[model samples]
Target: MITKYKLYFLTLVVSLLLLGCASKQNFIDKSKSITKETYTYHTFENKNKLQLDFYQSINYKNTKPLILYVHGGGFSGGARDENYIKNYCSKMAKNGFAVASISYRLTMKKLGFGCNTEASLKKEAFIKASEDISYATKYLIDNKKKFNIDTTKIILVGSSAGAEAILNLAYVYENKILAKEFKYAGVIAMAGAITSIEKISTKRAIPTLLFHGTKDKLVPYNVAPHHYCKKNKKGYLQLYGSKAIANKLKELNTSYNLYTIQNGNHSWNSKPMFVYFREMISFIDHQVLQSKYQQKEVVKKISDYTSTDL
Candidate 1:
């Protein structure tokens, strides 16, 4: 015969297990309203391959705008199809947009991005990743007709290291890789920063949406060293995070939106991807597609998640 105490303990264990499952579900949207296809974008000298996973609405139509997403992994490790990213991409596809998650060279995989790593090597990783982004864009543009993509409306989206690469491509780096006239429609950076705010002149600025945590230590919320490496360290490269980038855009009279998560941390990199999906779509539609010029700043406490997030 089972004792009353044993029965109560078993019931409690079951309850906790159910709650755990529910919390996991909250992180990703599981709707199946999208279609996905994978394509090889590049082949390296060693015969290794880089690919992109494209997502679109199941009720597909032509000339849809694309959200070219780059995954965050601190330049060392990350994949194009992380679950959270797929969830976000699926949600966007359902809302009448196409999404592409691409694979790029992880140059910093061997040497971690820390105080011990050389700053120049870190910068090279950025350049190499951005170059891959450019090549991915070229592949999509070349196959625009087949993919039914509006090449002109391709917005760049990234998380963490991915964010840094896209930001660098948008502001600091010249397009010596792609067509001279080619330009990204907009930029959505999640916990991203740039090397130089000076490159964000009137001629180079674009519609940008930035999401960052005020207390982010890995990627500064304002101007600070990358990973907060000490000045005496070789990897002490200063970065201009979301706040600084938005300020630069403001100075240039450019369209930009800055979402500051108070007391949040590096985790904000992926959280905003799902939590602020509506806001992201709004920015893309109004700021990028419609070419509306609007500058706005929003701040919310981390505790706000209890009332707002899924």
Candidate 2:
């Protein structure tokens, strides 16, 4: 009972609807296993809130590893969602590791010095941000069962100023000497500083991976032209190469790697980032941390990991 033109229009409308549904279904399929749930831990109701976005593993896990991300914005100018880490988190989650993009109290809020400390209140800022990171860790630790996490296998991954937080956490979490409640599997730093390496005298060896661009304009590859060799073996890698850092690690009898990207940009999400990520995953998958007391347990295992050392 319909005209030919009317019937044709109805058919086209149905085709368009089918296409729309298909497009949505494709997105669901791609991001299906990758969780993008934003868990609000604290609601400040318009003020600063401590939040966490969880990325879930799709396959290959009865239990999962967690990689917690601390975004870089120098402790004041960024959020957990800043710099679009969700994309990277999605990739990692899809690859079967649980990912968390975390929000910490901006240094200003912690210090109650918001817009007041104009002259770069760095020392205090680092302390406050570090505290925020620990709180996030405590949150995870307390909810380990709910999150279905391996409490023993948490990795603190931070960038830029957030690196300050990671280093501080590593130092404190050792010895349970500082009201320690959480334990970490490893730590990863992207453009992070090895602050207070001198204070690190504990035998609790945590595996560390440092990634930095050689041509970085900010957070220079070398701390100071004069202060390179004497203090930082990592810095010397920029001028010399990976072999220099590896040799230093061999000399110190520590486990680490420094990958210096030639002509890499400071903020660009380039090849260096993925290379860094891959190295970290390999380290985690290999489970490089054996307690100082567990030598007998992993002595044979270490020999098996010839690709990493030998």
TM-score leader: 1
lDDT of 2 at 92: 60
> Pick by lDDT: which candidate is best?
1
* Worst ten in a row by lDDT for model 2: 293-302
The TM-score values for the models, in the order shown, are 0.89, 0.66
Error of 1 at 256 (Å): 0.2
lDDT comparing candidate 1 with the true structure: 0.85
Error of 1 at 233 (Å): 0.6
Q: Please give the lDDT score at residue 98 for candidate 2.
A: 71
RMSD, model 1, all Cα superposed?
Answer: 11.8
Q: For model 2, how does the per-residue alpha-carbon lDDT over 1-310 read when each residue is reduced to its tens digit?
A: 9753345335434533543443221433566556677876554457766889888854434466678888877666677774347666765665556778888767654443222333235555666667666666667767777777766767878877676567656753233322454456677766655433434443544666666555555444544321133333322211222223333344556666566555654552223334344455556554443322111101112223233222
